[model samples]
Target: MNELLLDLNEQQRAAVEYIDGPMVVFAGAGTGKTRVITYRIVYLLNLGVDPYNILAVTFTNKAAQEMKDRLVKLFPHKAENVWVTTFHSLCAKILYTEAKNFGLERNFVIYDENDSIKLIKECMKEVSVEPLNFSAYDIYELICRAKDNLIDPESYKINTMVSHQYYREIVAEIYSKYQKKLLENNALDFGDLIMKTVEFFKNEQFADIKNKYAQRFKYIHVDEYQDVNYSQVVLLKILSSVHHNVCVVGDDDQTIYSWRGSNMNYLLNFKKEFSTKDIEVKEFKITQNYRSKKTILDISNILISHNKHRVKKVLFSNIEGEFKNDVKIKQCEDEYDEAEFVAKEILKLQQIEKFYNSTVAVLYRTNAQSRVFEEVFSEYKIPYKIVGSVAFYDRKEIKDIIAYLRVVVNPQDTVSLKRIINVPPRGIGETTILYLETLAKENKTSLWEQIVKIDDTELSLKVKNSVWKFLSLYDLLKKYKDTMYPSEFIKFLIEKTNYIKMIEENNN
Candidate 1:
């Protein structure tokens, strides 16, 4: 194993074999940070440490999957013991299994902003507050920011940004009220999962959990440590306190999640929290050149060094490269001409004699800036794909389809019902839903199920007819669900129910 790491750079070798108290791999760009971590895990297992006693955490699901795959290939049978997961996913499992102790349900749902906002609008209406004056997005952002800083609603500060002193009081009250409603429905917003877990650990019940994980994981490895916020760092500390074998891998220059609540304070204060007095502190500088060219490396270095405090390191490139002088700055008159210029450049690249789909990349500061190239590519019938913040699975149409699938799998999902009730245009509007919800609560059944037993003394004839139409369509789909795949069934149902026509015919 030592011979295997003989070829690694000094920093990489130190990271791979440094089995000590606390370690930080302050690697630079193109450095083998990942390589070192991978080899470190293998080395730990080789040192007679139980694979089940290792916990590795990464930022993205893709990274998690990659690490899992790599580890499995390294030790095929022992991989199951190793837990590699994202924060949200791991917390969800913990919260779910321990829901009884934490005032949550085993069969609860998770709601994104859209569903949470819909519920908030309902609550505001019921409370007789002016919904138009206080937007749902604004409320969500407030809650999110509060959670990011580990500040609960009660601890949240107030200022003159609000109208009256009572405004903070009002909003604070509403925030708690919204949380109660979500709890009643057994739903968690995106930020709530981890925040609530943090709360769980701070209290007495999680003392048992803290000990269990801390003792279970003899060594804990954290990736992208600089991108971790306060709660996450605290969680890491709790899990590593037992054995104190903790290793973190990150580059301060790449810590770009500050706006989303990440802070460099944790990385800087890590040494303070975990003392190396009875332990070892290893700082490995995995500074190397492999990925980027000289020009790209120089620009990245200059642009990123604007940050106030970062672990100092250097990157170099063996190959020379060039970039557009002055960033090719220009001001086009209109969007069409801008698109044209981009199209011309792409065409010129394609016409080059040696070009055989050679890799070419064009990057912009934002999604809006990518539009010109996208439009030009479309106009010229160029084959291209946009990989940006918005993923295909995140599109509204796709999510709506998923909502339907959710409802089909679990008919009790009220949120999915609210989304697709009038979606196909049966004309059942907000008023009908409010009335149906009242009866569902009175009967204590799912809204959709209760609608089946409707004694229409309270419903008007028009609304009753619309409800019948919706029920008929749902029944039709359920009757034939097994015959069709999700996409095909959705397409068929939309066409047969005249939903496509209704939506497309809306000229307004």
Candidate 2:
């Protein structure tokens, strides 16, 4: 390494030069993990590897941008050619240019949790099945797990705590149908995208591309490697087969996103998988932290040490500790009040010189706890973005509008359909839609269209009128499809659907 680049610590220096091998750098939080990754790319470039021959994957867009910035500072023109991107963004790019060969459309929409839940609810309605003691979120999780295991939904079955043979059979059936509906819309949940893409690479058609990508890239360096899911790891394994130059930097102690599908198994299995005849395996540790003070490091060590499976890690720091004595233990008065208290402390710190524009985040064990912080912050006009998943249920006006837009986008979405079915105090109830769906399927038309043409003899005249009005509103939406984005289309829907009228009269 050059003198300027050789300035990195011993761990960092080892991280940079081990560019030719399958190396795993076990870096603790606040360590120079970022610096090591950046320097590795420069080292590869210095070794006569083309910039386009290196791939660096990060977990977030912000990190991807930072990697590019760091690379550009060192090698100047080399930044533009290096592939530094989040998994989703990289997959989206691949799908945009190459997915057509794999039978996927270029313009396929990403179904965030809200879209998936909306679709799931619609399928439940279609099956005349009410959700049994489970929320839409619960079903989404089950679906995600199924996808992660690469279980083809066609032959999928749900084995759950529900002991009844009949109920288990019923959920499995509903799941099969729900998956078909997603496929019809060219939609894959986040997990499905990764899993399916892995499957695609394994198939004959993508085998050449896999070889091509691997040969094109000299070294594959992954950031936040602890956050890799099964499918992602599979993709990395395949792509690295050709070049056998993969470097991953992560701390097993920070493996905290199990609920979001991050697999701890990958880190544990990294060495065994990466070691082959042509491949070299090396391991390095970065125990020292630059970001945290000595006290903060001590606090983290005490708490994380309890995770027995975590690799033995210690955070050594020269910076002064925050507390005179380390106070590692934190007690929260339930999740909500804990957040409220945290919000108060953060707002108090906002007045300090250093705290300016430094976001004070209150991490929660669950999304529900975010509500407390949100309410407290909003009251004080503290600006913040609700990160993680889609914040549909979080926004009042947007949820109201999404209800209307979902009705327009996919009439098949059952949860919102159920919510809106009688929402306008529409005289139509649950049984009516079930019967209507059956009739619509029989006639091969929309339930709204089927209800419109059905005779009034079996139905109440009031119910008949509401169903006809619903069909007329759908017809109007069809007419104005040329004029609106999904948002404005929903705006038109509330007025045109007379849904608010139903709400107003019911409120009276």
Query: Stretches of candidate 2 above 4 Å error?
Result: 1-7, 158-168, 326-440, 443-508
Tens digits of per-residue lDDT for model 1, 261-354:
7887777666676775676566666767778777777777777778768777677767666654524456888877877776677788888888
What is the TM-score of candidate 1?
Answer: 0.80
- How much lDDT does candidate 2 score? 0.74
| Candidate number with greatest lDDT | 1
- Model 1, stretches more than 4 Å misplaced? 126-133, 157-167, 276-281, 302-308, 320-351, 356-358, 374-385, 388-392, 396-398, 404-413, 421-428, 438-453, 460-508
Local accuracy by lDDT, each model: 0.75, 0.74
Compared to the true structure, candidate 2 yields what TM-score?
Answer: 0.71
> Ten residues in a row with the worst lDDT in model 2?
153-162
Residue by residue across 1-508, what tens digits does model 2's lDDT show?
5774666887788678776668898898888888898888888777778887889999988899988998899888866788999887776776656777888765455566766887777777777777776466677776776666566555454454335767556667767877777665555667666666677778887888767777886789899899887768878888788778889988888777787678877886788878987665888889888887887777789888898887786879999965697543558877666666676777788888877644655566777767777887888777888778855465644565565565566664444455566665657887887787677677776554565575733777877887777677766887786698866776777777676676577689
Clashing residue pairs, backbone N/CA/C < 3 A, model 1 = none
User: How many collisions per candidate?
Assistant: 0, 5
- Per-candidate RMSD, Å: 5.0, 6.6
What TM-score, over all chains together, does every model reach?
0.80, 0.71
The residue pairs found clashing in candidate 2 are 53-218, 121-414, 121-415, 122-413, 122-414
